[model samples]
Target: MIRGVRGATTINQNTEKEIIQRTEELLLKMIDANAIVAEDVAQVLISVTNDITACFPAKALRNLDGWDYVPVMCTKEIAVPDSLPSCIRVMMTVNTEVAQKDVNHIYLYAAQSLRPDLSKS
Candidate 1:
């Protein structure tokens, strides 16, 4: 079945290094928590808050081994009033034997506030 894993994190700043680092941290946690392998990933969709324009989160994934073949895209999130700032979110589509209910989603840092119901915190 094609399952989806969701994750989100916040960066302290909008710099390229901060964005990339935070994105990498979020992706690694999501991938590890869900046992996601490169071959199983169909695509990754990343969205960042409008305030974060320094770099694309997808660029960070390119540095991962075997991620070069995976399709990744990034876009700006819809600007909503009172929304979390400097946030990066990801929805990864993957072919997995795991049931939908078994999938583990990750939310880190201040982004945890965005999904209190699903968060492990």
Candidate 2:
């Protein structure tokens, strides 16, 4: 079955380095939490707040082993008033045996506030 794993993180700045580092961290965390391998991933959808125009968050995966062939789509997150700034969000579609309810969704840094209900207790 195809399942979705979501994650979001806040970058300290809009610079390429910060975006890449934070995005990579978020992806790694999701992968580790869900035991997701590249072969299991169908596609990755990423969205960033309008304020972050420095680089595409998906580009951070380019240097990761086994991620070169994975399909990734990046876009600007809808600009909402009072929304968290420098937030990068991702939704990865993966073919996995795990039940949907068992999947891990990670939210870190300021982005954690975006989904307080999903936060780890």
Please give the CA lDDT of all the candidate structures. 0.93, 0.91
Per-residue lDDT of 35 in model 2: 95
Per-residue lDDT for 14-109 in model 1, tens only? 899999999999999998999899999999999999899998889889989989999999988999998998899999999999998899999999
What are the C-alpha RMSDs, in order, of all predicted structures?
A: 0.8, 1.1
Instruction: Put down candidate 2 lDDT per residue, 1-118, tens digits, no spaces.
Output: 9999999999887899999999999999999999999998999999998999988889888868999999999998888898888899999999999998888899999888988978
Give candidate 2's root-mean-square deviation (CA, Å). Answer: 1.1
Clash number for every model?
A: 0, 0
Error of 2 at 59 (Å): 1.3
On TM-score, the candidate that comes out on top is 1
Highest lDDT among the candidates is held by which one?
1
Local distance difference test, candidate 2: 0.91
Error of 1 at 80 (Å): 1.0
